[model samples]
Target: MRLRILSADERLQEAQGKTTMALFGPSGAGKTTLLKTLPTEETVCLDLEAGLKSVQDWRGDSLPIRRFADAVDIACLIGGANPAAQPDEHFSEAHHAHLRAQHPELAARLDAKRIVFVDSITDLTRQAMAWAKTRPEALSERTGKPDTRGAYGLLAREVIGLLKHLQHAPGRTVIFVGILEKVVDDMNRVSWQPQMEGGKAARELPGIVDQVLTLSLFRQDTDQDGAVSWQHDAEKGHARRLVCQSGNPWGLPAKDRSGKLALTEPADLGALLTKINQTLKG
Candidate 1:
């Protein structure tokens, strides 16, 4: 195929497109609950964590969830090229056929959805790691010592493939849910980031997504009756909110490509999407 140059109109149109969001926060910070507010009818959520207990109250017909039995199930969806028939590749026709037969809904949603949500990318990473261990190349026949180092690379490739797949889906948005972990240095300085097993995936994931958000809570005490009250947003929203900043004081590594929003109070994806739309229009 010959390379063809695109017109100015085409280039501009592509530039105006929206990018996906990568949401990460601590458990009980309402990451899952906030995601529940999205319109389920137009969204597809992959519940790789099995029973999403926090979203138990969600009444939008069980939140249009698709369950993945294990890591290989997800690996099969993001195909690539591998003689081992790695989840990223379809080197074996039998492997692809088995995956399609088992996960038809997931296969259909791969590139044909408006909104795709993967509940907890951290879990996805874990699943990928598990699948990596099953690969023969990751094992040493001599000592039978598993190649833990090699598994990290496979895990990263799987996640990167998944992100790219969702990002290129026509007119669709992807939200990768992940837990935030607190790390302390030798000096006791603290920082928060996505909770992934492998250092490679956790370290480099922020650069792969359009936005990285951190959710937190704010507390205040009443003066009149000496009552304690809690409110998170400085401007508006609820008792909690999601924050996005490029190296803020809170020790979260976040970035926004549009540079339109600094924080999203109440930590709701629905509101974030609204702000994104408004900013794009402006």
Candidate 2:
């Protein structure tokens, strides 16, 4: 290797910027439905939820869904680990190994112009927790009790490692679907965030990706003072909102490294990208 000088224009060509989106919301808020609308071409969704019911009746060609059976299944699919060394005779384990052999590109997803969707980190964390139950180190055999802290730590490490893989994969866009959980402060203020069990992943969701937004169904309501406040309405068929930047009255966790996005927008990536592009133009 040698030190090389490049013009500003030439340096720009080396940039492999990719969009990393973390979308979290309550169930039935259309989180998976929105993901169904993403471009189908070159897209592969890690279907942790195990079905396309969110977009079952929808029209366009549904993207390929890779249903993962467990946390190890996900790890194998993503080529994060080799499962051949694992015990044989287990159908799920063997299936994971077979799938990995079939889809080596998943490990190198960032090099393509594809999008990888990890549908619902909430479920992924659950799977991680389930894995902890199998380990005697994590669960004592004598007492038949599980180590809560150890289980949480494992979940955090698994999720953080997955996030890192997608974040560093330069050319491809990666989207993580998550469920929303609330935390109450001393003042009894309720704040919404990703539902990651056990450890600090709930707090680190925004920091691990290029963007983090919460999808919510909102309703238009007028206050006594004639001011309107958009409140969350779990009932669908109404207003759908995506919170991009944080510190809003809604108190949903969100952030974007690209500061061009509005604080909130409709639940569509096109809208967000348009706003960002328009800002860049200005």
- On lDDT, the leading prediction is 1
Q: What TM-score, over all chains together, does every model reach?
A: 0.75, 0.71
Clashing pairs in 1: 79-88, 80-88, 80-89, 241-266
The candidate that wins on TM-score is 1
Per model, state how many residue pairs clash.
4, 0
Poorest 10 consecutive residues of model 2 by lDDT?
60-69
State candidate 1's TM-score: 0.75
lDDT of 1 by residue, 10-87 (tens): 654554544577887777677777657787666667676764677776754323333323434444454322334455
- Tell me the TM-score of model 2: 0.71
**Candidate 1, position 182, lDDT:** 77
Would you give me the overall lDDT of model 2?
A: 0.65
